[model samples]
Target: MKKLRFSAFLAALMLTTLTACSTTDSGRRTVGQYVDDAAITAGVKAAIVNEPTLKVSEIQVETYEGVVQLSGFVSSAANIATASTVARSVNGVKSVKNDIRLK
Candidate 1:
């Protein structure tokens, strides 16, 4: 019984350590920072979806250290601009990098 318990504890410890040292596409970020960035990305996507003129499904949002990047294809220049503006307006966004292309 004791050996089984020790093995379980050791496994948990290794998992925690691996998660703490994990690197994301934009490089290393603490777990808190990663969660924050995820929130920012979700917020941007929600804002885009709420815009009547924008196609939310066509826009991809990514956030790294508060910097939002908007990608994917849209209908026009206006849509690209709107996506950038919407991403920028989201709270915790440091800046927006719009790479949306016309479809």
Candidate 2:
């Protein structure tokens, strides 16, 4: 049991080291920047869900460096537009990319 525990600990240490050295394709982000992007993504999703006309179940939100990206299938062009508008209204979002498509 002690040997198995040591092996597991070693594996976890290696995994943590690899992840700590990894950089996202969009480029490297400081921990603070990553947190900001996460907040922006959450805010955009909240806005979409809050909008009565938007179907939150059909929308996806992603944010990087303060730019929010909305990509998913909506029932109409208006929903796509509304999603973009809502994302842009978020406080930390620097820009909005609407890639929503009509079904």
Q: Tell me, what's the RMSD of every candidate?
A: 3.6, 5.6
TM for candidate 1 is: 0.74
Q: Which stretches of candidate 2 lie over 4 Å from their true place?
A: 1-27
Residue pairs with colliding backbones in model 2 are: none
Please, what are the lDDT tens digits per residue for candidate 1 over residues 1-103? 9999999999999999989777765677877789899999999999998999998889888888999988899889988888888888889999999889998
* Superposed model 1: Cα runs more than 4 Å off: 1-27
lDDT value, residue 23 of candidate 1: 71
Best by lDDT: 1
lDDT of 2: 0.87
